[model samples]
Target: MIQLGTRWLVGDEPPSRLPQPVIDAIYEVEGELAEQGVDASEWSWTLTWLEGKPVVELDDETTVEYDPETDSAIVTAPEG
Candidate 1:
């Protein structure tokens, strides 16, 4: 399992796949770090667990929760 900052990602073949948005986020962060001449791989990292399965959700609102253990992001819709 690869770790970056406080976020954790699960790497597994079959069924479990990394989300594109998460990957984009990582890349974005990586790019920013690179611009500063800082290598994220060399920085101190927090402990994070990989997920065993993929969990996805679609919501009309912009709220979500990240689960480290499951490596999942739960999103909730805004109440009208």
Candidate 2:
């Protein structure tokens, strides 16, 4: 897991403080990417909150939004 500030990530687990929701989001995104044939080693995760919503940014293109209410991640891909 990756830890940045208060966000704990599964792919890039850093030695920082993080919350439970952020951790769950990282794992969720990791699973989703793996199902798509993307390995965890091929990417990184950054967790943050946007307007009180947990957002996980994968690499520089993909953004996964975590909804604690539904316990799911909403992935947003970069546009070409």
lDDT of 1 by residue, 1-80 (tens): 54332433222121124554444433454455568775445343122334533332212222333556665555444478
**Span of 10 residues, lowest total lDDT, candidate 1:** 7-16
**lDDT tens digits, residues 25-80, model 2?**
55666777779886557556666656666566767467767566776656677787
How high is each candidate's TM-score? 0.35, 0.48
- For candidate 1, the TM-score is 0.35
Clashing pairs in 1: none
Report the CA-based lDDT of candidate 1 relative to the real structure.
0.39
* Weakest 10 consecutive residues of candidate 2 by summed lDDT: 1-10
lDDT scores in order: 0.39, 0.60
